[model samples]
Target: MTDTPDTLLDGTHTVLTPEYVEFRFTLAGIYSRFLAWLLDTLIVMVGTGAILSGLSMAMMVFPGFASALGFVIYFLVDWGYGIALETAWSGRTVGKRVMGLRVIQRSGVRIGFYHAALRNLARPVDRLPFLYLVGGVAALLSGSYQRLGDMLAGTIVVRERRLKAPSAIGAAAGEGLLADPLFVSRVKRLSAEARELVLSAALRREELRMEARLRLFSALGTKLQELLAMEKPAHLSDEKWTLLVAAALIPAPGARTSTGARAVA
Candidate 1:
């Protein structure tokens, strides 16, 4: 990770992979996070209001039960909102997506259900003393602008940024691997989902533990080898081979564009 004066000041979290590839992301500040939270809160209130309206209508028959049920529903909606969306949407909620923010683990990987739930579960404490006063102060104090929830969950909210494909991308893949017509053809035949997995693995390889890194790249490389109907090059390791393929199959900016006919894992 290269730490320049500007990068430090602006909260750029850069992760360097084993292959010396750098993944850089800008940390979301408290202001953007607050805006995102406000939007989510607004949405949740509308949804809860709709549910409460039905409960209010039923309250005529069983006022006590319906009133109690309404309270439960509000709590569930408020607490479940972030957990549900962040898990299903891969660290993005309606508000976060709209604001171009995503919650990811400290290692720069996507957050899963556990992280989402833990973070959201801590929300009540973060909201102590009204208007998220404690959370706001915590974020201001944190270099990465993490609130209590984020700190507890080992996650940080980041703003999505687009990176351009570099010219002469074949260097990482060894001398002339990308120039081989047969290899390029096989890469182009990989499905969109396969392309993404390969690239993500290659780019984030260093973030994973050694065992995980080996297993993942081995499985990925083997699958690609079978799909492409080519023997693994004897000189390259599994991880290196996978990185070569990823370098060949570059993801377009902000979208997954593909020119493939067959599906590959």
Candidate 2:
């Protein structure tokens, strides 16, 4: 694998895979997660309450002991159900699916039962003293939306929904771009700050107006030039843009042509 530096978010250092960096969340992700949680909790509570009520009625014969048993059963069913759903569906509980949030491994892989177990198990600590106060603090401190349990489990919460595509990048295969050896290697080698800047800039591209975009490109170009310590090209072109990006990831010994000898900035 490539050895790129970690990305910093809100002062936290986070190592990122191309997929993770590329798919970074925005305000929409936060809203989606909240909605999903609300829906999922409502569904689970209603379902569980109905079952528990029936169990309580049946246990009327042994009031005290039966009530205790019912409580235990409820806890188990709720926790187990959530775990099963998240593990099976890659970090998505019913609520998350509806809201389009998902849990994933730090490496950007689908979360499995083991990882899910770790995060769920830590829920007690995260929720202690208040409604996820500890967990919230951890998430705020984390580069990714990782609560205490997720951090310990090496997992992250991410947006399931895709962002609006950047027109400049076109509709090339996302997988193919990430899979390129040169791209992967370069990404792996970035410093956390630089990586974060790159990721944030990429994600924000569509939001930028023309002037802002030009300004950003110029700033990025300057930063890249400093990073590579290369001479500035007499003129900038699309090929130059591609090469600069490539150069950020890999060291090109000399200029090479795709079909024609296009000049790269």
Candidate 3:
């Protein structure tokens, strides 16, 4: 699933999931991402400046406590700045927001505190030997334009955009093949919630963001593969397989509609 700019279609990286969702994220290039990092650094510097100013004033009043306070502020400003802002702002610090960039899971999942922490914790490594030289090389060479921190965190930087529902189902719209008896049995074995989840995703596949659709279908496809104790044919995409399974389990009208259903995020 790794994709470099050279492999991108019309300069956009496509993330496909087994659920038939496809997300086309325009990767934030090394230069833009660096600029955003610089902005965040400036913010950190401002906070540091304020803390130092306060510490200097306090040093005259309480010289003993000044040293301790400086150390604490230094640690917090160096690390806590990024962690606190990213966790609270859904992966955006002041610089990222200003640069119209955001951090998100490569798989299209929402980032959590753990992800933010992991990425930030690895920041020092990314900065090894100076001005993010290691991270710069990694981003330039890696598919998804990821730095070491992003790779460690399974995250990516993408330009922010409004998520719009698709007007029609793209890959999810197709005639499903008849289910094999074994496949049918496997389908029946799934829990009601699981079955309904697949059906719902299939029904609303058209309206989902490409990345989300791909993720859903990929996950469902893997689940089906496990249940059926079979491997997917190389020719069949995850969405196709999941749709076939959905068709077998749900034969209701409009289940295979050419026009996609409106999806609610």
Candidate 4:
């Protein structure tokens, strides 16, 4: 068990990745989690109402199949809903999005389909002894505020802070000529996901603590280094290298780009 840093406020935990980059995540407390869950339940109820109405119509027409169809609808609305939305929205259901919350892997990356499935599948177990009594206790006692499913699935819920400034490639300003055209090409070749990470790190750079910032950039820079197939210059901070990559990747004006760029398109 990792010790929670003294500097951290209550309900916050730090994750140190393999790249030695450490990030602080604020664990979603029971109150907020309950609120988010309540919102989701309401959504599920609405969906259930629609399904029930349809089922009622179907039953009147074909009474023999009513019970089975009703059961199927019940299962789907109760279970399938979360799985579908979380997977599709990258761990954000309608409720989570509204509440500014997200489910992510313990390591801080986005959760995969398998992770989503595993967590939701374990939902029944979490509800043991009624009203999430078992799960709530587990979360209250756990270091990372993990319920049984989250622990089993190696996932956690965290607060998703909205960036004050756009955390997009085009928002980053270039300094002088780019480091190398080859590097620029490499940056261009980066996967959309990787680029998003770089953009996010750059935009949120000012918000991170010094140690946390270094770790994050170091980790991201190392990954970028591998993609570029070269070592980063020692003098330039890891973050600077990441920013440089962002700048290089940003298509200049006359370029339509996402992340609030002035490009046409």
Top of the candidates by lDDT: 1
TM-score of every prediction relative to native: 0.66, 0.51, 0.57, 0.74
What are the lDDT scores of the predictions, listed in order? Answer: 0.75, 0.57, 0.70, 0.73
Give per-residue CA lDDT, model 3, range 8-30, as digits (tens): 53145566655455655677777
Cα displacement (Å) at residue 28, model 2: 8.2
Following a full C-alpha superposition, what root-mean-square deviation does model 2 have from the true structure?
12.9
- The Cα error of candidate 1 at residue 183, in Å, is 9.1
Ranking by TM-score: 4, 1, 3, 2
**Winning model by TM-score:** 4
Q: Give the runs in model 4 whose Cα sits over 4 Å from its true position.
A: 1-10, 61-68, 165-172, 176-189, 203-222, 229-238, 248-265
Tens digits of lDDT, candidate 1, 37-151: 9999999989898988876767777876976787788779988998999998768899998887898887777778999998999988999999999999998898788889999
lDDT of 4: 0.73
In the order shown, the candidates' Cα RMSDs to the true structure are 7.5, 12.9, 10.4, 6.0
- The candidate with the higher lDDT, 3 or 4, is 4
Cα lDDT for residue 22, candidate 2: 32
Q: Please give the lDDT score at residue 94 for candidate 2.
A: 84
Point out where model 1 deviates above 4 Å: 1-10, 16-22, 64-69, 167-244, 247-265
Quick one: how many clashes does candidate 3 have?
17
